[model samples]
Target: MSYSTLPRIPSGWSQSDSQASTSPVSPEEGVVQSVIKIPSTTYLGVESTVAPTPQFERNTADLTSNERAALLASSSSAVAGSAADAPDQWAWRDVGCEARTLGRLSAPITLAASLQILNILVPGMVLGRLGTDAIAASALAMSVASFSAAAPLIGLLSALDTLCSQAATGSSRPGLPGIYLQRCLLLCIASFIPSVILWWNIHPIFIYLRQDPVIAAMAAHYLRYVTFSLFFTLAFESIKKFFIAQGFHHAISLVQVLGTPITLASVYFLAVHPATSIGYVGIPASVAISYALSSLMAFAWLKTYGGSRGWTGLSWEAFRGWGRMARLAVPGAVMVSSEIVALDLLTVATSYLGPTALAAQAIVSMTIQSSGTLLMGLSAVTANRVGNLLGLAQPHRARNAATAALGCGTIVGIVLGVILYSLRGQWSYIFNPDPEVHAIVKRMIPLLASLLALTVITALSLGILRGQGRPKIGAYMNLASFYLVAAPVGFLTLRYTSMGIVGLWLSFFMAVLTSGLGQLVFLLRTNWYDQVLKCEARLAHDGHHEGLMTPENHPSA
Candidate 1:
């Protein structure tokens, strides 16, 4: 509320005038005025000899006392010294490269990350030994299981990711821990609906597929086990997202590393042990056990790290606080679910082509799906960063973060595509040993390789849109691409043209490409930055500062 004037100095200042002046300005002397806010103070400096820039003066008027002090500390003569001496403090620069820089980093991160998840597919190697039909059945089971578990959970986790990231960025909001716990409950409850549907409808679905009774029976068994595992699956996912939003990627990765060996061991024991009646049941059983173990690990990590701090108490009121959370989450859920649903529909289409085609489709899709973890991981990080920036009332930074994520995804996608293409021959063996399936897969590899590259681009762009909180836009884009463009295009080519299964794969590529392109266009056309800024402004007006970044006056265009 107060203002100040500078001491007497020449209107048109020169260094030599200062040298002859009775009170010479020392090079190392301080000239900034410190502004005080409750419990925090900030300083701003003015040049005694020159008119201040409009932006600089505006920043002075806009920032609180603490923000001003922080800015002054950044620009002062001893700024570096002060920074080095102070405890690690939050700064815009410390948020790192929001857009371009992050995108560059995400490329290698995506490729290497794909390998880490691909390691999870070694279990399929054991299953592939059970003949082409068995391998086909196994692949179908995994697809169904992953979709059922991931669809409901991804949305809840995405919301958690947004909330936790905002809190970490200094929202000064109480009840973060409470909000996290309640969401965990909501996710668990929501997951049960899908679990029940998969379990109850498995028999009817297999009938629709005209599966041989034996194959149908085996798939149903697998579904039952997978259904049981959904609870743990949801739990593990929620905890992982919670940590990831807090920038704790290593913990989740570590748990996956530890759980992998247990998974392999369980799969081996189930396949070989005569005493065990489950036979192939070991696959889903191993999955179930692994989820339990991983969830427990995540819970322990959360308690040790987050529980010790302010995130201890549980409160249901956190759930009641925001209709916005639910609104954001619903479309997010739909966008992620659409991807899974599209794959399931593809499975249904492939079923009509016989077991060989189904096995081939399963392997290719599963391999592509495994690469999805990398996309999801990078996307999750991007969304969290974007949401946090918006929370802090920094729309430009939020947009930059989203852009960076897409760039990272592009590099990752291309590299992964090349790797998949190069290993096309070897990858067939990972699915099954049947000569027909292997031969068909090898023939299809080239087309699939091309698809992978394009798919990566599409997937990454989807990540960018989701991160921007336009999940509904992404959902619509997917619907248009998959149903209107990709599916119809592929079906016609496969039935009428000689492309066959290969045509189907090509369609998959086209659908994703259309969806990605559309989403990217939306990002460009819509003033998402302004949307984010406006949301921040509305929240401030409503006195909804809880779980948000430090408040700032909304900027006028």
Candidate 2:
């Protein structure tokens, strides 16, 4: 029935564009907006509300420019108050718009992320040329570095996905994003010190864990050398996150372009060149120098072009939000690290399988790592999209962006899976010369290829959870999946039967399915509007109350 003939208005019906254009509308309300009151969550998720008034009060602070646009767009209510309800039924045009945006965003990130992988892969190649044992040691070190340093660093900074993206999008306060950046950087640096010490003294720990003594000694040495480089790596990552939050990532790509070649050249010169052949130590040293240089370049770019992004200068206020940020950061790290941690633990266990098996497992694991990190490019984009839209209180658009990310993830997974599958025989050659390693990797490649889509889905879903400020959900899900289901299945399959490394990869199918499908289902149940409320509540609690993000002077605002 027509709106004119309707007896009473429906709660969530959206008016058509023609009807909206012909009718009078309020700036504060939509063309045919809801008279129904917002169900309050009251200071995050405290949940207390009164009877709906004939007219309800709305906060002006929550009415950012984006919120105003969302209100105007509410003319199409089939999309309706269902924002927090489901992850489907988005307009085709909106999906196309988001896909185009995601494509453009993915370019710089994909380049940067691929270059980051090169820093890991090229070093392994350098080690491969040294010897089989050397390549095996390098793999062990890489796995250790992943969970010990890289995972924690990435996790701590994951909060930037939520805070910086929201601050950049929803707040008039430009410096707000930078404030969150500063806070995350501080936490990461603090976390790094303990990790450095652990690496320095890891020989005994590795021995205690029953790793091969010689390989453990070598891996321990690598971590110690790598520790010095990690600081610079941290610096580069911190600055890049700031760039990402602002949606300007060309600079990060540029830094990677310069940094990748320099890293590779240094690896060759220091490891292979007769003049400075430092043997094994050269690999870590080159990585150190490369990161230091890249960090400097990224910082320089931020200083010159960052004014528009709201980082006026560092403030003492950056010290205040430690508690608020950590709540997310710790979970973010857990969520991001859970799978990596599981794999690393498996890598540790693989040491018992002998050097050849260890080497083969490393190659396959590296192949998987490369694909997963590459997908991180898209994951980062998805996180930014969801966070920004939510900050504007545009739940419908946020939901749409999320669904769009999943679609993009599928396409990317298919393309990458094809490439990996096609390269199954020769792919391990890049990391090692051993015919045995190549054969093992070739065997595992099919299984790895099958997991590509699932990995992409999990990565994107985690990003969405991060953006939603519900990272702990992913952390919980991943921990349960990895420790409870996947790891047990893998260890039992490998030990009880003679399936070997193939069994290990086969076991991962459970982890992927458990976490991926679980997160996907949970995303369907998300209350998008409630998420918006939580975002605002978090910002007000952390950014506004602390007087760090907004331009206004009063601490009491």
Candidate 3:
């Protein structure tokens, strides 16, 4: 069992000679021992003496139990270590990791979205109780304010989504998110000037665009109150992104949850109270107050909680990154605005069809928007994960994250499509009691299903692109799909065919499909190693000196 007890070699051969014979030798005879020679007869009738090289011994009986155990354990550990260190290949192997990561990121985001939707819907609900005319005015005001003010501002501020997420993962500075927040706040304040002018002149603009004079005037009145909340709303949005990038998504959800009741109560008191002369303006004013409160609460949490580690306080450092931020913000705003414009145009097209068709469109639009909240949550998760991976210089994992996001989005889309398809007959009734509108919705079920699926995929793709710091690509795609393709198709179909709402839905579906497919192709063809280098360069430029940390140097690597 032990080496000392092994049988001794023959008298003429030493231990070294035996060991040499057991080991492999070259073709030359220098390393061979003469004692191991063998006589051989050649095939050509020539007799010769040749030495046969001995095969290495497979038997391990010469070694002790302890030595054998040690060798086996070391070999096993080496194999496991290599496997652990190996880069992920393009495959569906890591579904569990992907699913878990997506779930962790999605839950809070979805909850926050639900609360946000409640904030908007509560005001509308409260205003509906005032009177038919009041409800109509409120609706007009919401539409105009959303398209003219909310959409552009939200779009512009979206730049922080990329910057903060990337900065959190990529920047060496602890206060990057705070700096981003400060920069965005400055931008929002500057934007407020033009927004004020637009809100002030909305009545004339709406009239010139052939809106009902009474509704236009009422909407202008509504915006005047809501305009005060603009900066606060933008501030809330910026801070929300700041929290999200720092992996503090739960805090945002909590803030929104806490703010919802305040919003509802404010709206009720202002709109329904007899002594209050706020009237329809109270709805927007309540919204503004709710937003401002949410921002303050989130800010308080950031300061009191450990989130303030990133807060260096107001400094000139906040102004240093305006150019980089603008480069992204402007294109992001355009990208978001293009999509909004397309939807608005679709709404316009629906209007010409009749009130019934327009009503049906509204129901479908609300349903689609609600369903899209889930995708939006997933998209935020995707961006954050991808940005984090890229920041760590793990391109393979980043690729894996992106592909996994697409897969998860696809699975979610399919499930959603199936559920929506099954409920298509009765779903519209939740939004509209009318049988005719339900019928139109029932008829458009297939288009709705397709649109939902496409929307999920496109949203995930856009998120990945944003995380990669390539929002311009998304902007260009939006421009091409919405303007060059969907718009023209929508116009031609509506003008020449009796397809009505179906035609408009089809056009939007095509646009989404085009964008999604284009992004997928780009993702597949991307040289991720190059992206890793670019990510490193970005981080370096932003004052992060931890340039290109390899697997050996990275803590997680």
Candidate 2 all-Cα RMSD = 8.8
Q: How accurate is candidate 2 locally (lDDT)?
A: 0.72
Q: What CA RMSD would candidate 1 show? A: 11.4
Report the number of the highest-TM-score candidate.
2
Ranking by lDDT: 2, 3, 1
Instruction: Residues 34-121, candidate 3: write the lDDT tens digits.
Output: 2221122221121111111121012212211322211111111111211112333334555445555566567777777767676655
Off by over 4 Å in 1: 1-119, 143-149, 177-181, 184-188, 273-277, 307-310, 318-323, 526-529, 534-548, 551-557
- List the candidates' TM-scores in order: 0.76, 0.82, 0.77
Clashing pairs in 1: 42-69, 43-68, 43-69, 99-400, 99-404, 103-404, 103-408, 171-548
Between candidates 1 and 2, the lDDT winner:
2
- Go through the candidates in order and give each one's C-alpha lDDT: 0.58, 0.72, 0.65
Model 2 spans with C-alpha error above 4 angstroms: 1-89, 545-557
RMSD of each: 11.4, 8.8, 17.2
Candidate 1 local distance difference test against the native: 0.58
TM-score sort, best first: 2, 3, 1
| Model 1 CA lDDT for position 386 | 63
* Residue-wise C-alpha lDDT for candidate 2, range 1-557, written one tens digit per residue: 00111111123434332223333223343222222123322222111121112222133223222222221122232233332223334567666665665666678789788877887787777788888777788789878888988887888888888888777655546578778888888889888887887788888988888888888888888787788777777777777767776766676778888999999999989999988878887888897899899888877776775433447678888888798889999999999888888888777777778899899887777777777767766777788778876664556667778888888888888888888899887898998888987888888887888888678888999999988989999999999999899889988988899888888777777887898988998898786655765665577665543311221321112
